[model samples]
Every structure is written in structure tokens, then in C-alpha cells.
Target: MSHSVEVYAPQNWTVEQWNFVVWSEGAPSNTFGRSYATADWLLTQTAVRPLVGIVCGSGLGGLADLLKDQVAFNYRDIPNFPQSTVHGHAGRLVFGTLKGRPCVCMQGRFHLYEGYPIQKITLPMRIFKLMGVETVILTNAAGGLNQDYKVGDIMIIKDHLNMPGFAGNNPLAGPNDERFGVRFPCMSDAYDRELQQLAVDVGTELGYRDFLREGVYCVLGGPSFETIAECRMLHKLGADAVGMSTVHEVIVARHCGMRVFALSLITNQAVMDYDSEEKANHEEVLQTGKQRAEQLERLVSTMVTRIEYNNNYS
Candidate 1:
């Protein structure tokens, strides 16, 4: 007689339970192979070997449009890629040149709240590294937690508070893959200082200082906007801006020894006062992105050119 075994499905499970299942499976053995395959396919599609990989934040998909000689692939068409479900995210991978430097830009990004395993969410970073990307630039729209920040301000990410990681919910939570990185990775230098300085210099040169600020970012597992108390607590803890993405991608990129640069557009002020009537909404986020998209694009493209110059001739 044969015995029937019931498999526990993680589909309807809690986040904690789902994370346990993902951890148990470990990092997929085919990660590198799959990334290599994808990279090879992309190379065949375009002659550009990207040195820079960009992950655009909410409503910032337009950044990829600035690329010269662009070739784009939708997430669904790319092998082993996760689809983007959020509005304002276009779900495409674009390859081209930025200021004559080869680059790849993700028009959209996946999130933990979208029911994707953390590893899957960060798989693109590994693929980017395998595609010969040496540097990663991440941009996101965030809520301004610092009282001094105004909507539409660009906040350079000097540091970040990974609130999810504090609770053992991290992109690096699964079994370590030697091919990608060491078991224990250092995050202290995740965001490159030289790139941060370059961004500041570029913004200054563009006369964007009035709306450009630098501060600490906080990442939270989000599909819901923060409560006033939560906003107050994060602000008290020194978080100047708060968002749902970036930190995970940064962690993965750093693990693979890629240089990282990230910035947040403060789309709205966090509601810290219980009596305040203002509410946070995605429309506002997209609108703010539209308002600053041109300037932000100019800043990033200029930074890309400077990074290329520094690497080649400095």
C-alpha cells in the first residue's frame, strides 16, 4: 500500500510562515545559471554591455526613456523575471546608453508585499551583476519624515534603517550562496560615498539645491501607509524618509560587490500629528514624480556621465 502525503502550501500563510518556507528552500542552485542565461540572451538582443543598472521607483519609469539606442524587454518576456503589479511601474527592462555609457534600467520593481519571495524580488540584482554591471543606481518615491523636508524634494540616501531586517525579514535571510557573496555581508558601505558626493555636486551644478536634501531612509514592509504614531516613531529614530523598496535591492547588490547609489523623492510628508487632516495617497506620489521627473532625470543622467568619466579617466 502506498501512503499519501499532504504538502503544506504557503499560498495563504502569514508573512512569517511564508518566509520560513522560503528560507527552507534556500537560494536556488540555478540562480547563477539562470542569470547567465538571461544575460547571454540580452547580449544577443543588444550590443550594449551594461556597466550601470538602474531600478526606477514609483512613477519614475520615464528615466529609461532618456537612454539612447534603447532596446526594451517586458518582464513577462524575460526568463525568470518577476512581473511588476503596481501602478506607475511599467514592468520593462531597458538596455541602452546614457551619456554614451552602456546601461540597463528596470522600468519597474517588485515588492515583498506583492506576495513575491524576497529572493525572487532581488533576483534582478544578481542578473544585473552577471550582465557585467559594476554600479547600481536606485531611485524611489518616499514620504518625508523630517520636518524640514517638503514634497518634491530629492533626498540622497546617506543611510537606511531596515526595520524588516531587524525582525529577521531580510532579502539575505535564506541560505547563503557562495557564488553571489559571503554568508555574512557588510552593509555599512552599501551606498557608495563617491556616488553620493557626485550626486550632490551634480545637483548643485544644476541649481537643484533648493529641493535637494540628504538624509537617512527607513524601509518598512508596506502596502499600507504608516499611522501617525508609526511615522512619529520612525522620525524619532532618525529616519528622514520612509519607503517600501530599495533596501532589499541594495542589500543584494552590496552582497555581490556592486557599487550602489540610491536616492528618494519625498512625494509627501508623513502625517505625524493625529489631528492633521492630510492623507497619503499613491496619486500624490505619482503627481510629485511627474513634477520632478525632468529635473531628476537630468540629475541622474549627469551623474551617470560623471561616474563613467571618473572610472575611465580619473
Candidate 2:
């Protein structure tokens, strides 16, 4: 269905109408200026000049607790920030130090299924860019598509298949902002190879090699678990894990010239067989994330200490 022409005019809409567009569909007004304004607001609340940014996914909010001397803001307190309604999400932006390296963390993340437009959901990435973050580490709880992967495994994202991007719901779909990046940004190296290697090294040192795997993550618009056929197809199409968030934020972060590294905690195994009695649910996802939260934190925080020295974008 197509929207009426009047919907394009954000200025004339009521606060409720404008919000519905941004929070539900999308806004033509999600421009560079708006991102800059929000970044300016956040800059004042924290004394730290964070060079690293981390996004905590699902039940992984414990990662934020690792930060020392934190200054946090509720999403509702920030201009242009969307509130997170997901149960596992804490809906806060925190600025603090991680092992003495200045960093910022998102205790929660926005999602396509959370009534947010693609751009609105990825707004934090742009805010991260404007706040002077050079490297971004993202973690998510996902369903495992690779049969070799078990529940509680950690899959380092070497690449991803943006299922929503294929349908033209990409966060960077609208007007181009040259200040942030080129109109046609190359996604071929979206996940920084060096960072991927570093994560492996860290995980190995921490004796997490057994549960650590690497593969492409496929992101679908969710809130609904995939059918058996869909899971089979996605796995055959090269997805090791499947999820709803992270990919858009990765795209936005990369577009803004940040070095990116991401990983997924395989919360549940995707049921690819019709006869299987197993099921996928948020409770399972959150529970798995809770179980693996500590090791995930150790892996990321260890990488953060070495990121500045090893992070070469070239």
C-alpha cells in the first residue's frame, strides 16, 4: 500500500502524527541536522570522549555494567531518541570507561518490529558517529541456523545477509547525506576483518573457542519466529544465524566510517524440520543471553582494550 502525499509533509503533522511516521513507518525529516542536534545534547551529559561504542543486545545489558563511572540517560530524556519497549532492553545510553578506555554503551537497541522506521531505529549509529566513536562493537541474541551450532554458542559475524534490505527497507534507503558517507557506500567489507580476528584471539584466550563459531548473520523483520521452511531456506542460503536487529545498525555505522565488529549469541536452534517438537520463543532467547552474558562481556571488554592499537580501517 502507498502512503498519501500528505504523509510526506512532516512539518504539517501533529506531534502524534509525526511520531507515528518516525516510530512506525519513516520520516523524510531524519536528516543530518537532526542527528547533529541529538549528538550535541548527549555530548553535554558525559565528560568522557568515547572512542569506542558498544550496543548491548537482548538480555546482554550486563555489558553496560562493566563500564566504570557511568553517566546514563533514559531514551525518553534524549532528543530524537526512540524508546525501546522490548522486555530485555533497558532503553538507556550510557557513557563511561571500559578498562580505562573511554567508551559509550547502549543498554538497549531499537528494532524494526518495535514500531520504528528503519532510519529511526539506526539513529543511534549516526549519533555514535557524531559523538566521535571510531569503532563499534555490537552483540545480539539470535536463532541458530547452522545445524552445527547449539544453543548458547557465540557466532562471530563475518558478514550478513540483510533480508529487509533486499526488500528495500534499508536504513540508508532515502536521500543521501554526503557528510556521513558516499551515496553508494560499499558494504563488501562492512565487518572489519581485523576486528573479527581480534575477537577470535580473545575468545580463544578466554577458553571460549569451543562455543565460538563464525558465519554470516541473516536479519529478518521479526517478532514472529520463522517457519520450518523459512529456517531451512535461510540456512541453505548461507545464514549461520538469524536475527531481527544489528544489521541495520552495522550498515549505518559502517556508512559513517566506523570500524565495526559484531557477534551473535545463539540463543536457540532454528527448527528446520517439520516433525521437530522444538520451538523458538523470546523467553528462550533472553534466557540463553542471560546464561552467556558474562563470557560475552569478557570477550568484548578484552577486545576493547586492544581495539585502539589494532583498529586499522585500511
TM-score of each: 0.89, 0.90
Stretches of candidate 1 above 4 Å error? 1-28, 308-314
> Tens digits of per-residue lDDT for model 2 on 1-314?
01211222335546565445445533554455567667767886777878899999999999999999999999999998899999999998999999999899999999999888888899888878778788999999999999899999999999999999888999888788776888888999999998899999999999999999999999999989899999989998999999999999999998888899999999999998878999899999899998999999999999999876434352
What RMSD, rounded to one decimal, does every model reach? 9.4, 7.2
User: How accurate locally is residue 36 in candidate 2, as Cα lDDT from 0 to 100?
Assistant: 60
lDDT of each: 0.87, 0.87
TM-score of 1: 0.89
Residue 218 alpha-carbon offset, candidate 2, angstroms = 0.2
Candidate with top TM-score is 2
Global Cα lDDT for candidate 1: 0.87
lDDT of 1 by residue, 1-314 (tens): 00100011213546454344334444465555455556656777887888899999999999999999999999999977899999999999999999899999999999988999887899999888767788899999999999999999999999999998999989888667776788899988888999999999999999999999999999999999999999999999999999999999999999988899999999999999888999999999999999999999999999998884224210
